[model samples]
Target: MIAEIIPQSSALTKKYTNFYITNLLILKNMGQVLGMISAVLILSAIYFRVGGQKNFSNGLFIVGIIGEILFIAIMIMAIFD
Candidate 1:
């Protein structure tokens, strides 16, 4: 009975561990991509502002802020996961 139970529990643990690791990896990648996108958006916004495109710059800045927030959230989740 002990031997049978041990193997079953170990198998379940391994399965869950793999799933957890996979999720963490996905979150990490998403965070990295969001960070890059946010950086580009912010830079583009700055460029637009300098070029006298106030409306476009403001829109880009808002989107960039949202992306940055998402990136931070994902990174926090990955860290605590």
Candidate 2:
């Protein structure tokens, strides 16, 4: 009976471990994507500035900043995890 319980508990533990790992993977990928998006937005903002679209450029810059913040948050979470 004890042996059966041990195997069952271990299996449950492994399932939970796998779930956490999957979530961590998703978070890591999301952070990477956010970083890429922020980079692109910054570049686009620069392009817009050169093209004289101040409004759109500003908007993109704001969004880019938000993305950068999210990326940073994810990085912090990763460090803690």
Candidate 3:
């Protein structure tokens, strides 16, 4: 009984550890993608603003800010995880 429990527990722990690591990696990747998207949006917003499309530029700027916030939050989670 003791031997059986030991193997079972170790297997369970390994399974959970693998799951956690996989999730962490996914989160990190997602954060990176979000950061890149945010950078693009912001840059586009700047271009549009300079080109005198104020409305579209403002919209893109807002969306970029939100994306940046989400990216930061996700990165923090990945780091702490």
Candidate 4:
């Protein structure tokens, strides 16, 4: 009885652990990609602003800030999940 229970519990733990790790990995990758996009947008926004395209620069800046927020949220979720 004891041996049977131990094996069953261990199997379940292993399965769930794998699932958690996989989810964290996916989230981490997603966050990384979003971070990169945000960085590019911010840099372009600065370049455009310097080049005298105020309107377009503002739009890009807003989008980049939002992307940065989303990336942070995803990273937090990955940690808690």
Candidate 5:
């Protein structure tokens, strides 16, 4: 009885582990892509402000800051889902 029960439990554990690994780890690529986009946007915003150095460039500076915040939020969210 002991020998028979051990094999069945081990088989069940293996099946569940495989299912989680196969289905759950595939979406990390999207997070990487989003992170890249976020970085680019922030950099561009900074570039715009630095190049101009005028009152008119304030909007660009704000955009860059917002982009950075959004990037951080996305990175945090990606870990759980």
Candidate 6:
């Protein structure tokens, strides 16, 4: 007689979200925090310039804006492709 082997199903299924994510006081990874900081700095510089402040810093802020535009374009291409 040939015996049939029916494997048991997994009792430990994964949750929708990670355990750390579901819990409070979870630490954010460096990349996430840094990305948010960079985005904020870029936004603030643009806002200050739009508010009509004039100085050497304004030149730097303009350069930052150009760099941000290029960075965004590259990111979009990478993500789409």
lDDT per model vs. reference: 0.86, 0.85, 0.88, 0.87, 0.59, 0.48
Given candidate 5, what's the lDDT at residue 7?
50
Clashing pairs in model 3?
none
lDDT of 3 at 66: 99
Candidate 6 residue 30 C-alpha distance from true site, Å: 16
Candidate 6: what lDDT?
Answer: 0.48
Error of 1 at 27 (Å): 0.8
Off by over 4 Å in 1: 1-9
Error of 1 at 32 (Å): 0.8
Instruction: Provide the RMSD of all predictions against the true structure, rounded to 1 decimal.
Output: 5.8, 6.1, 6.0, 5.8, 7.7, 11.3
**Which parts of model 6 are misplaced by more than 4 Å?**
1-53
* Model 4: per-residue Cα lDDT over 1-81, one tens digit each: 222334445677667666767878998999999999998999999999999999999999999999999999999888766
Off by over 4 Å in 3: 1-9
How much does candidate 2 score in TM-score? 0.83
TM-score to native of every candidate shown = 0.86, 0.83, 0.87, 0.81, 0.45, 0.36
TM-score preference between candidates 1 and 2, better one: 1
Cα displacement (angstroms), candidate 2, residue 50, comes to: 1.2
Sorted by TM-score, highest first, which candidate order results? 3, 1, 2, 4, 5, 6
Q: Give the alpha carbon lDDT tens digit for every residue of 1-81 in model 2.
A: 222334435677668667777888899898999999998998999999999999999999999999999999998886577
How many residue pairs clash per model? 0, 0, 0, 0, 0, 0
Candidate 6, residue 19: how far the Cα is off, in Å: 36
> Model 6 has how many clashing residue pairs?
0
lDDT comparing candidate 2 with the true structure: 0.85
Give model 6's TM-score versus the native structure.
0.36
Better by lDDT, candidate 4 or 3: 3
